[model samples]
Target: MKNELLQIGPVTIYGYGLMIALGILAAYMVVVHRAKSRRIDPSHISSLTIWSVLFGFIAAKLLYWITQWNNIIEDPRLLLELSGGFVVYGGIIGGILAGYVYCKKKNLNFLQSLDLFVPSIALAQGFGRIGCLLAGCCYGEETNHWLGITFHESHYAPNGVKLMPTQIFESVFSFALFFLLLYIAKRKKPDGFVASLYLLFYSLGRFVIEFYRGDIIRGSVGLFSTSQLIAVLVFLATCAILISRWIKSNRVSHT
Candidate 1:
């Protein structure tokens, strides 16, 4: 759980940040390969990847600041400490919005682009979670289970005891989702179908995983966590898209 991966001179590389960069690079490679296979313009993949990373980082920081506004206002220095603090939901929302706008401006097929990128996003998320594990952030509650991982002497670990390895669990889950989506991609289904399924499943996974997290809870509305609130919104949006597609398909079939 050591945060610093390496230090050379005045520059110190943090494991979390390094892992995030690696994840983005991995996702970019996957997207490029897929784009080539689909006969889509491969050049657009680089542009999209760059935009996604830039916007995604901004969104993550913005959302984290919003959630911890009181602390951030009291101590503005927290912003300088990029070793920790980021919300995945914000990145997803921002990346999708940016990608949609980019596709529209270029007169590209937005749904198809989303379908192509969904799995790559999942793969990136999986690697990012590994970074979280190494940094000891996004940790889980203390447990005596066999799966508990100790993060003693870690800056991100609150207590010097073993805890559930929630980060690893999430990483594995996201990787599984990535492969599942990749397998489904071979079927060549509807335009938004892959993206919709990704949203639904990822939201469900996040909702369940939030319960294991021991981080400061931002309180919940009714029975839902703050993450669950976002997940519900995503799930509903996916459902709406699927329903609209179904209606359109039915009409086309009837005609």
Candidate 2:
């Protein structure tokens, strides 16, 4: 709804892009504030975040291309369409990889840096989902429920039909998760706990939400959508990390 928020002369501001820009700015500001509180150099975090985001965009686009490989092969123009078709998992993975490399180069504690910044990722996602809702990209299955929303001008969603509004649901969940992560971080939990919790909760939420998504363009793996498959793997991997960390912590305490 209202994808074109404003236009003057040859300049036009689109809803999705505007929301993304806001989200990135908000996330960076939060990270900077957090860095000051954590006693880490805000300048370092600023550089790391910028690098992670740039790589995250590349990863998101790359994964989107992989998913839509067939469509791109048929119509090569789809490859250049940058307005949509990003995979969240790809972005997450890429950001983590970028952060890891940056941490290695800067001699920063990888887990500590990860824990310090993970919450901002969720914060950014909250705004990103609102972008999705505005652009009507990640729509949900048709439903007669009261929570359904109708998008008349959505280029992606079916017009005149009430849909489940998965984008809003995810946005709310992301905001809540952002707050929860902040709370957990304030509690002074273990080094890796916050990062693991972020992965665990996000993966679980994404897996469940994938069931309600109506966009078949996202592709599937056997009985599950592509995101669902990735979610399961992420969840299991996170569980394994948590268990390993817990056991190691117990051993350290006992020793």
For residues 1-255, write the lDDT of model 2, one tens digit per residue.
Answer: 878889989999989999899999998988888888889987788889899999999999999899989899999999878878899999999999999999999899999999988999999999999999989899999999999999999999998999998999899999999999999999878787899999999999999899999999998999999999999999999998888878988999999
Kindly report which residue stretches of model 2 are placed more than 4 angstroms away from their true locations once superposed: none
How many clashing pairs in candidate 1?
Answer: 0
Task: Give lDDT: candidate 2, residue 206.
Answer: 93
Q: What's the TM-score of every candidate structure?
A: 0.94, 0.97
Pairs of residues at least 3 apart in sequence or in different chains that clash in candidate 2 = none
Clashes of each: 0, 0
lDDT digits (tens) for residues 51-132 of candidate 1: 8778987897788778788887899998897746888998998999999999999999999999999999999999999888
